[model samples]
Target: MNMHSIPGRSDAEGYLFTRRAAWFAYAMTIALMLMDYIDRQVIVSLFPYMKKEWNLSDAQLGSLVSIVSLTVALGALPVALFADRVSRVRSIAAMAAVWSAATLSCMFTRSYGALLAARGMVGLGEAGYGSVGAALIASHFPNRLRGALLAGFFACASVGSVLGVLLGGVIAAKWGWQAAFGVVGIPGLVLAIAYLLVRDYKTVRLTPVLERATESSTNAARHIIKALTRPRTMLWVCIGGAAQLVVVSAVWAWMPSFLNRMHGVAPDQAAKQAALIVLCGALGSVVWGAVADRAGRRRPAGKLYAMALMSVASLGILAYAFGPGAALGGSTQFLIIAAGSFIMTCTVGPVSAIVIDVVHPAVRATGAAVLALFQNLFGLALGPVLAGALSDTFGLQAALTWTPAFALVAAGAFVLAARTYAADMGRAAEAPTETNHLPLGAARA
Candidate 1:
């Protein structure tokens, strides 16, 4: 169906397809997203095992995670831009299959170089998945549910992440680490093929070029630039999203290790504990996303405010959970860490909705890709390496203690985004004119 054909404001009710079809598509998208994270994260739980087997350093271990983010950052834009032009679903499915196969390859690799290359391939496969999948979901659902739906969508990462770590740790410790890769990879491969059975939405690219020239418009270049450079688009969604991720990525990547080395927990035990903390993050995503959606109904700035508060508050909690000066017991620290994780993840949904609220529908995947690029480069790529480097210098504990502070920086960016949010959102609300083609600003994705 032409999902964007409805004449009213961009929202769930405006779905050109039936509610059931939209939801079915959403279910498939989210399930595949789950598989994506499972493949992306399963290696993390096997870190200690691989490190010992290869005599690798902590920094090398960190590279395994960082490499995925790096490749994703590099691949996001081009692939998503391509999907915007051709087909998002097929692109996502194909990418998912590639990553899953790469994940399976890890099970057979004998050397570190081969495994590293495999991880890079997995990252390449994952690069455009988030942006394109999110675009797919956004196209199916309405704008009002954007926050919660995207939150629920993003929360799948948390769930898959938890399973990857938990299942990898348990399976590896019992059966062998190689088995962990296959367990996670197989499901993703199956799901990728299953995704092809879902339907596609027909959305004509909305651009300002003349009707006669629209068929072969060079205006796509200009519109892409405008989409990427919009005020709120540049300042808030991409940058602010990256800022919050610094803490999120660092904590997720490092939390299991922290519990293992510092607290005298076994690898499997640490993975379980870490998984619980991440599970809290998943819960926080839905709760915070729902809160953002409700508050946004009253004031458009509510999502930004919600994000800012979550970042700042989570920072304070993380300090107590990780800092050396604290008098809290180990059990208390775990609980506090879980609380902090839950609050920190609240930003996931709002940042997504905000970008969609501002960018044009024609390039929504590109917008999502831009956000993913910054998020990976700034947050995922930098956060872990920075922590690992700090650990190499001072200690892992010191690095963990300091990493949560990035949330303060993120909170500041959210406040800045709020400043221009109203104006930007107002601009996005004006639907495209059917008679005369208007500028990109008038076309909300």
Candidate 2:
């Protein structure tokens, strides 16, 4: 049952066209990503309980989220490069198993230190999964569908985040917070093992005659360094994505507490309402991604332009949602924040698509890993910690009010990404640097 062996699903360029196995991998990868975030985020729901029991400070609470992102940032490049050099399928499965097992271990923690250790393990497991998974999905679909497909893939974060908060709240309330970790952790383990059965594409190889025409001095380290850095577009895209994700990560990490502390909402109700806001983000990821796909039809840079526009729009909505408008009724505030949530996530797909667009397929996983490294380090790793510190000083409301300003920085980076995007794409296509040999470990045994 080698699904990749089946014919009629790919073009001459080796990009997969319409195919059953392609869609199946899409489903499985996206599902695994969903479970990944669920396990990663479910800890947020237990923050209140943990704080009560542990008597932790806001910094310690924020550290729980930051440490995971920090570890993921540290590990992303190495793990992604290893996956590119090894078997992506196996790598992905191993990552899933590690994270799931670590998450399950969270249930046994007797002190804050134990939970911190376990969370770092979860980060190690989750680090390279995104880039490897994105690379696999990109290789299986044509460029035309790249934006929508990747965006849809990333949209699972919203779903996973929402569900994690919702489920964690409900289960923790009825049973206990430990039960919340168990419920989210077990399904990921199942999905990890099941992923081994999925078929993978073989790397395209050169015939003997064609091998002579290819360059002999191809260096992987050189290629990765040159590709990820020189292209002004790639650098800006990575920085911009990190800048924008700060807002998204902070909101996800702290909104439940915002609801509880500011509005007097119960834990279940707070998580439930926060989930609704995040659900809007899920909707935005898919909708904006599809829109970017359609808009990118004739223009190579259309997707990046769309990202910049949407990001600016999001900044305005969020600024309003958290500011003077705070005095509005709950219903109006919810709608405003929901709108911001949708707009805030518009960059997920287009940004990912842009990264793959500017790099050769051979280096795509590493390219993605590099971009994710910045995103996690600057955005996910820092956002919550910054928010928590601000909350400690200025109050949570003011801390959130200022988070939207970072979106301007994100939008500016997107504009910079657009300026050199088309040029970068053209240069990468014309360069023969990556054609010397197929990527290491890309062949099936």
Candidate 3:
């Protein structure tokens, strides 16, 4: 059934559900997001054990983490482009199965290369989750409440990150690193089944008149390339949000290791601590999204300004985290780091909301895919590797010192991003009538 065909007020009927089915769909999407986070972070929590077991060098270990992100960057655009032509729900379910199985496969690997290969496969699966899921959620929710809903969905990352670290750490400590992989990896099969049970909401299609006039063929490659090359959009994709991912990746991937090496926390303890920080960060994301939505209602740049301020705060916190302060040695350090982590996470919901807001709905998936590609390639792929290499060459503390610099650069990007909000909103407002075609099939139907 075409869900959008239901008769009612557009805003009420489209979203802000009164029906149980609508909420169920929304919850299912969030669950998918949560599982996606678990798959990505399970390896992170097991890093300490893996390091000890494999006798891996810092650079080599960094490469292991980087491989997944590299694969993600490579896969994101293609999967995103493909999603436009196929069913997003089906694509996500397939990806979930692939990655979940890959995660379990990590248990069989005795060599670093084998493990890296497994992680890369996981990355391949995860590549579809972000772009496709974001697009799906945007389509499901009305534009008025999009920011709040996406924030709720994105907050699952924090939940998944924390749970992955906590659960993986405990499992690894009790059983083995392989057991950790098995536990986190096996759940995807169940989630995949659950995903199949959930209904797929039909997207609102773009007008056909515009589609025929604008393009001779619905070539996915052409669409992806065009979306990626949009000047203002590309600028934000590469420099703004993706740059922040770099610093975030470096910290989230290695912070547990850092605590163990420098502060002398055991593997499990460090993981738990990291999990706590992630939880706080998750809360911050939800709160920030709500506030930004409210503020954006009054001013167009509200979300951008919130992101900018958070970026600056995150920079200061990271600098403190790496500095030679007495505070780093105590339990208080966890609280401080948690606060910083929360602030960093606060940017996620708003950044996502703004990016989606700026682009036309038809190319939303493509825009998100390009953004994910930059975020993975530059931010996730390089961030941890660069930090780990620096730590190896210098010291852990010194490596962390570089985080603030990246954070500052991210903050600057947000400042630039702030300027484009009005223009983006304007473009989006005019897109339906002016562009004449739905970029995605949903708009045309």
Q: Highest TM-score, which number?
A: 3
- After the best TM-score superposition of candidate 1, give how far the Cα of residue 225 lies from its true spot, in angstroms: 2.6
Clash pairs of candidate 3?
Answer: 204-442, 204-443, 205-442, 205-443, 205-444, 205-445, 206-443, 206-444, 210-436
**Local accuracy by lDDT, each model:** 0.74, 0.77, 0.69
lDDT of 1 by residue, 126-178 (tens): 87676577667767667666558876776677778888778877888888888
Candidate 1: residue 379 lDDT (0-100) = 82
What is the clash count of model 2? 0
Residues 190-267 of candidate 3 have per-residue lDDT tens digits of: 887677765555433535554342343345446556654553744663576767777777778787787788788888
Predicted structure 3: lDDT? 0.69
Candidate 3 local lDDT, residue 299 = 79
RMSD of each: 5.0, 5.4, 4.7
Which portions of model 2 miss their true places by more than 4 Å?
1-30, 84-90, 133-154, 193-222, 290-306, 360-362, 433-445
lDDT of 2 at 341: 90
**Which pairs of residues clash in candidate 1, taking residues 3 or more apart in a chain or in different chains?**
11-142, 11-143, 12-142, 361-445
lDDT of 2 by residue, 323-374 (tens): 8768996678778888999889888767777887887655564566567777
TM-scores of the candidates in the order shown: 0.82, 0.81, 0.82
